[model samples]
Target: MSGTLALVPAAPGKRLGAAVLDWLAPVAILTVLLSFGFAGITSTRSAGLIIYDTSLLALLGSIGAGLALVYAFAVATVEGRSGNTIGNRLMGIRSADKDGYAPGLGAVFLRGIVTGAGILLAVLASVLVAVFKWFDAAPLILGPLLLLGTAWAAVVVVSSAWDRNGKLRGWHDRAAKTLVFDVVNGRNPVATGGIEGPYSFAPLDLPPVQHVASPVASRTPVVPGPVASETPVEPLPPAAHAVHLDTAAHPETAAHPDDAMDRTQVRAGVRQDAPEAVLRITLDDGRDFRLERTVLIGRNPAPAAGESQAQLLPVPDPGRTISKTHLHLLTDGTGLWVTDRHSTNGSAVTTPDGMRTALQPGVPAYVSPGTTVHFGDRTFNVGHA
Candidate 1:
């Protein structure tokens, strides 16, 4: 590839945030159910005081244990099917295999089980010990088990950061052979070599032109013939000659119409013998949109009177962060060119070298493969098919 390979790792803070969100819903549901059940069991004593019984405490312990098990199973099932939990989807990150494809349901399930079962078991054990007052009787065993469980949980949380390859692989990821990537800027997993690499133009494979020379003995002696008078042709100007030489050297350039010449197409057409390049943009939500000659991007765009054309890409922006007509992408030959349409939040382009430049409205920017473009809070990367 023209640029070095860079894996887009989801920030540790975002990962933690997603995990918290994922757990919140189940915890809230369990807490509400337990609260209502406990209210019915508690007995009102003299002076409006409430008395709790051992049975209520035991029920609380059972509820906690049951919730833990349910949470683990639910998370695993969801993640296995979609490679994302509710939190991960909200944070624009997802799990994938090493090559960038979605880690199948089996892998995701295994990861969820490995990372969650131990922690849930520990929590369940802690609840049982606390409710039954067994910790005081077996402090040695209970204390050690609690500590080990806490340590395991902590290790899983930070394991991705500890990976030597910077692939953002946690213990669950390693166990399942999965990797977490920021969907916005991650490299395409299925593309050949991940991205299109730099290549030089070579001569087309054509049969060698054969020139047959006349044998000297077979040549006829020159016989004078009547000369025919005609107007002498003038030589072409220097500029015209130069243009001719250029067209001859790059035959693909001659095929494109004059009006079709653009920076993106010109560069892409340089290698005429190479396969036609395709442009693909992958969204943070695991959606891939292939760009045609013209692409319109925005949250939504209303159709005006007498305008029958529908928007090319009408993305749903629940936060109202993206503009109605944020930007436009055009396929210039094999490459892509993006132009901001005076968006309210503006837009930015991140080059392959990690440098970001704010885009000016109406000015087109060539987006190379592996480069990312950000529009408001959303982002997409340009890649080859």
Candidate 2:
């Protein structure tokens, strides 16, 4: 329900790619552990031994449980601190809240719990089957339960592609209200404009250009003159002064009246006559930011102990949707341009004419006056101030 939900979501392809990598990592680790354990057990087995030792079975069980817990804890810790796991980092994506801010540790924990729920269920079912194996009827029920747990986990992951909002969110993400966005495109969703509702604009019509004839030409008299043969003209006498008619002296012959006063002062390659054109970005909460030169917009990076705050413009993004350095804004006397600094959520521009365009990463786009620039959910209006 927060305004941050308006922020752009990550692509589904990236989400699935990252998820596969993350899931495979733990599986790889567990496989290695199992392999080593299997080799040790194989070496200790005797031809005369009809049954395996209970201690070995217990050790194997312990290893399985430990691996599962380790996988869950590792993912939770990594995401809680920086919203990036091995898979997320590799895929150039990270998780955040709808507001494009970092979800707190609690949310990360919840997400991890939900993500690992299926695995945990399968493990529980296995434990139950092993403990109750003395009862011949137990496997019949526990086996189906284990299959169900595995199915549920698959459903959880596959369901991510089914998000109606196209956020590519899984049950874990929905439970935690978290979103995954590309590393170079994610931005603070809450701070972007137009979250309250649809914006209504009146039709804008510019006056048509008019070309009028000069009053002098209209009033000039037309006289018929006799055709004469081409003849050499004599030069004027030195005593006869030449008359030069100045347009300023004869208003009737002047073209545009305001042309004389329209001159602008040029300083250091910039025009200084008119008020400096600036982009005034006003947040939905009434906070505003003025972009003059170049500004780095994003969430503040984690500061070191006793370190002063960064010089960058920090937007409040509790969802962790905005990158530490989202994008760069550059402005001149003519217009403003925005460049995506390889953020996770990407940036966009909405023109006054109601056209929305996505900006390419590392590419700078000119923002027309009265246009809205969106960085995730955060938005700012660009215009002459």
Report the number of the highest-TM-score candidate.
2
Residue 119 lDDT, candidate 2, scale 0-100:
64
Question: Lowest summed lDDT over 10 consecutive residues: which window, candidate 2?
Answer: 194-203
Instruction: Please report the candidate that would top lDDT against the real structure.
Output: 1
Where's the lowest-lDDT run of ten residues in candidate 1?
192-201
Q: Tell me model 2's lDDT, rounded to 2 decimals.
A: 0.61
Residue-level lDDT tens digits of model 2 in 1-385: 2222333456667766777788766666654554454344322336864333334545766886688678778787767655777877787777766544556578888876776676676556555644543324545754576567556755665566778866457787889887676655644322332122112111124233243443333565544344344654455445422222455567687667555355532323434465655555555444555555666678764323442442357776534446677777777746777888756567888898899999998999988677887876567776554
Instruction: For each candidate in the order shown, give its overall lDDT on alpha carbons.
Output: 0.64, 0.61
| Tens-digit lDDT track of model 1 for 295-355 | 7898785433543453378765543446677887878657888989866457899999999
By TM-score, how accurate is candidate 2?
Answer: 0.42
